[model samples]
Target: MLPETVLRTDDVAPDIRFDVWREAMAATMSPMHISSPHSSDFWGHTRLLTLDDVLLWPVAMQASRYRRTAELVRKGDPELYHITLVLPGSGRLKVDHSGRRHLSTVNDLYILNSSQPCDVEVEENELAVAIGVEIPRNNFPPTAERAIGRMLGHRISGQDGFGAVLSPFLSHLVSRNSAHRPSDIPRLKRILLDLVTGLAARELDAEPSLCTETRRRNTFLLMRSYIQRNYHDPGLTPRTVAAAHFISPRQLHRLFEAEGITAAAYIRGRRLAEARRRLADPAQYTTSVQTIAQRCGYTSAAHFSRSFSAAYGMAPREYRELEHRQQLDTELRSLAPPATAGRDPIPA
Candidate 1:
């Protein structure tokens, strides 16, 4: 997974929480003029996930206002692009130089350019939550790059089109950060980049710049998605998939060649991975190996056992037993009390 940084105003004294939050924002993001209610206390929290060159920040806090003046832009600017997905608040953003303004509300999204002077005002009386994605201005393809200028200060609806897919994907990513492995970051980053680019292209109606290679890659992605959803179906095969996509079996093979694996092999690998996960799950302990094998597309228990051993260097039964033992050890450790010096020992 991506590396994460979490900041909370609760970590500091209530009186100085706003000051600490302002400093942290200036260091992590760009400098801005901030204003909040005249109350004696402040509360805010932010979680930032860094993936390669992209940054995702999810924030929640008391309603406040912020402004990035031309002076601040001139002093120091990263020249980044930001897409803000507003969750539960009302706000309006104005591009000072362009005289463009966008009124934002719950489930709305807006794009901003770091090189421009902007002012934002959030309604008070309730907490406001938003997730912002930052990327280098040049990260988009030429088609999307041309559209960015016109998109500034314009509200994009998160309820439909590309926004519909992007909104939930980002929310889920932030909510499930702890469940991801390090190796999954690169793949997730690529998917996010593609989705962002596609959204821009859709907005600009730039189908030509999407090009043949990009379309091919998208087709491959769709094929993989189909496999994932249909892996349990015994009728799935290379010919069937190619026919569904209106392509020849030979073309299907060529598509997978780019991934360094054959279609059949990829399918088998995904099935095996799912089977292993099910086998290791504690809730599936009473489930028979033969049933799991059938559920994973293996018609014969012996065949599944042989293939599982070849791939994982152990039989399914042995793997399940080992996972069970590990789970029990973890439970025992959690139940045991901590040892302390000069403290009476608890009776077992």
Candidate 2:
């Protein structure tokens, strides 16, 4: 069945609302929230929340005096699974199982297994969005034991791993679902659940269980997408690219080999092509050839000019001038339209 609840604090006093949220959540799920100033209210700046389904909890919050304690577990049980992502701001988490207190800032991820308890605190005036996935106690995936009560908190930016793709994808879904149909929610739920399991397996360093190949393919597409987005970095070489994908140098090369190009060569070719196109543009007459070259990854002006001449059989300056004139003539021809027979031919 489709989820049937959208909860917010405006309906009640913030302190009372906090208690209501905790008890209401505990009835259908296993979780707890404790705050330092027990009398303080937290709703004045917080936003309304909608629960798509119990399989996932997506919440967006902006708080000024935001201080709270919370835990999530299986419905009607003390143990199960829960995961958290920090969409914004910075705070600290203390996981008893790990006996460590870690900081979570923008883009960091946090995971918790319900078999045990977790305690976390947020600073005042912090803003964040979080999604929690709840699963039955024994329903935890086979590799779940390894990550029991583990908190994976750090930026998994640029599609490096499951966290990278999952974070942005969930954020987009949660934001767009305001107008989404009920039928579409189930498919989205399955994807998020599968991703959570995959992430847990990864956190435990386990090889993918069944859908390994599919996951690998998705991850590759993700890495390629990141490359496209960062193509202008100039320093985006194999090493940097490998780091982004969280893979070994050999692995990075193999991914490219499968696509038929060496990493460095691909980057260089893209830079050169972008430079050539810019040089052929007419409206950019005032832009210097050296500037274009540097923008396209050439650091030395002399080397760039030499390479440009070799590639096009003329210096960039000469080529730009020729292209500029050609463009002007084309524009003039286009604007003047065709000459009619009644028009007299003029001397050249």
* Number of the top lDDT candidate: 1
Q: What overall lDDT goes with each candidate model?
A: 0.80, 0.59
Best by TM-score: 1
Clashing pairs in 1: 1-181, 1-182
lDDT tens per residue, model 1, 269-343: 988999999999999999999999999988889999999999999999999999999999999999999867797
lDDT for predicted candidate 2 compared with the true structure = 0.59
Q: What is the lDDT of residue 341 in candidate 1?
A: 70
True-vs-predicted CA distance for residue 265, candidate 2, Å: 20
| Count: clashes, candidate 2 | 3
Question: Model 1, residue 133: displacement in angstroms?
Answer: 1.9
Model 2 C-alpha lDDT per residue in residues 167-271, reported as the tens digit of each score? 876676656656666777656665665566566566556545536554554455456656655666767787888897688878878777776888776776677
